[model samples]
Target: MTSTVLTFAVSALTFVLVSLTPGDAARAVLGRDATPEQYRQLRAQLGLDEPLAVQYWHWLVRAVHGDLGTALSTGQPVLRTLEQRLGPSLSLITGALVVSALLGVGLGVLSAVRGGAVGRALDLLSMLGLALPSFWLGLVLVAAFAVALPIFPASGYVPLTDSPWEWLRSLALPVLTLGIGGSATIAKQTRDAMLDEMGRDYIVLLRARGLPERSIVLRHALKNAAVPVVTVLGLLFVGLLSGSVLAETVYVVPGLGSTAVTATQAHDIPLIQGVALCFTVIVITVNLLVELLYGRLDPRSRG
Candidate 1:
């Protein structure tokens, strides 16, 4: 029920915001030299002459039926365009997510267990990760890995169907760029959670017993600390989606991020709304999964 409300609200807000932006669909399609008569006709044809409320109502109705309308720029269905672009974006996002989770959790555990210099270093790195712009980092990575060392392609995506190895190679830099910040964030959260868990009464009890230090930290403390860590990871998923725009643009990956940039540049309202709606849905779905995982990890959450 909450998810439904959020989805509806996000869709409506996206439409309203896009509608409020400068320029209309007709002008975007007709160009600057179009005469008054042509502009009027185009406006009528595209229903841009209608009230904003009526326009939103009509769009909402169609969207409910899976018809996201046509892109003013390409004259193709918005859903079709999204489908064509979603694969690359998903690949990039998935790779980044995996990289962030592994790196973040590992660093976090290490820092929490072995404090002192390691913890301070993680704090500094996390600050840098959060401060650095994804696009700037992407550029640095490209220069070092692609230009200086010539280890990977600087731009462009290769479909996994064509060559899985090439696809992974192409995504490697963008993933690192997008994932690094998220990993830093998760590492901080995991470290805090681990520290808290380590200081709990149960931890002392386990230490007092004959349990191995490795088993206590990994099997018990880590498991107990997982809920909050999972929550941070879920939130980071949304950040990753937003950051993909910069990462994809810098890397020239033919993904939804690039498509979104193109749509916004052309004032493609339908395409923009479609992309926003897709992102909102993805975020909500990931959060829901996180909640379910939370319940699984801590049965108390099920209540």
Candidate 2:
């Protein structure tokens, strides 16, 4: 119910904001020197001369009917353009999540279980990750891996259908940039949750009753601590997905993020609106999934 209201609100607000932004769409397309007559005709042809309420109503109806209209800049169907770019964005985000999960959970468990030099080192690394900007990290990685080592390509995206290896290679730096930052967040949350779980009376009782330390930490503590970790993971995934704007721009990836940037720059109202709607939908969907996962993780919350 809330999601439905949010969707409509976002659509209306996005259209209003984009319409209000300083710039003439006609001039954007036809150039600054276009005469007033040309601008007037272009506005009429594009239906921009219509009343705001009427234009919004028409757009809402068309959107409901799965017709998102066309991009003012490229004249391509907004939905089709988004569809074509979806694959790369999903691939990049999924890779980042996987990388973050592995490194984060592993280091978190180690730091919680073993408190010594190794733990301190991991803590320091995570702090660095949290402090560094993804774009800066991306540039550094490009310099070292792409330029100095000449191992991975600095920028450019390859479709997975063409070759999985090539696609993964092209995505390596961007994924690392996003993943490293995400890992810090996940790792800290995991560590804190584990520490809290470990201090519970049940854990001490298990240890006193002759449970193996390994079993206590992995089978008992980790399972019970997972609820919070799951929460952080869900939020991190959404953040990374949204944060792809920087990654896509830096890597020259033709994903939704870069497309949104391009649309805004060109004053492509329909394209921008479509992108905004898609983002809101994705966020709502992820939140719903997270709620379901939370219920499963903590049976006490099922009621």
Candidate 3:
């Protein structure tokens, strides 16, 4: 209940901030010859002339009933636009997160177990990944896969319902960009958490009791280490909420990030507010779920 209200408050705040940016669709559509009188008229016509409090109240009421209002740029409903573009963006992020979780946790396990040359290499790689920007990484992946190898499309989106192969082809580079960056962040967190778990006296006692190494690490270490891993994941997801803007732009995927860029460029208040609110809600909801998962994943976390 707290989180639900929290989400609403944060999302409401996002609406106000995006709506406050200077200019509007009228300014973008009309030249400077667009007089102050003309601007006021246009704002009134769009109902954008209202005070922020009034605008926010009406928007909040409408959004609760699923009417997200219309984009100022195209005068199209925001929900309709989101529906068309959400699938590819969601698919890309979901696939990347899954793959990253597996590889990252696996590498982290190895790093915790070996503590040798392999561990050093994994740690080093994680650091590099942490430093690397996703947009730059996307460009590099495109150059390699599309430019040189010609294996994947350099940019574009394909609907999953249209063709599975097309979807995969279009999603590969964006996935790699996200996965590489995400996994690196997760790997470091996992490595550190696992290392801490292994140092616990119970783990030492388990080793003394002749528990199989695999059972000890997988069953014991991982279960205990998961809380922190989940924390990092929540943080990473928050990062992804905003970071995806560049990734989406680079890949030409019609996600909210691209929508945001267009909305901002065109000074489309409705679209901008809608996207910001949706993204904030998503990130907050993800974090809330992670919090619940921690209560389940780590028994001691309840304390």
Q: What is the TM-score of each candidate against the true structure?
A: 0.95, 0.96, 0.90
Candidate with better lDDT, 1 vs 2: 2
Candidate scoring better on TM-score of 1 and 3: 1
Model 2 C-alpha lDDT per residue in residues 56-93, reported as the tens digit of each score: 89899999999999888898999999899888888888
Evaluated at residue 291, the lDDT of candidate 3 is: 74
The residue-by-residue lDDT of candidate 3 on 1-303, one tens digit each, is 876787688767777666667766788866678889888888788877778789888878898898989987887999888877677667877778876788789889899989999999988888888799877888899899999999999999988889999999998888889888889888988998999999999998999999999999999999889888888877877777666788888889998888889998888777877787777667767877997898899666678
Clashes of each: 0, 0, 0
Taken over the whole model, the C-alpha lDDT of each candidate is 0.89, 0.89, 0.84
What's the distance in Å from true for residue 238, model 3? Answer: 1.6
Clashing pairs in model 1?
Answer: none
Q: Model 1, residue 90: what's the lDDT? A: 92
Q: State the weakest 10-residue window (summed lDDT) of model 2.
A: 18-27
RMSD of each: 1.5, 1.4, 2.3
| Ten-residue stretch with the least lDDT total in model 1 | 21-30
lDDT, candidate 3, at 75: 79
Off by over 4 Å in 3: 30-41
User: Which scores higher on TM-score, 1 or 2?
Assistant: 2
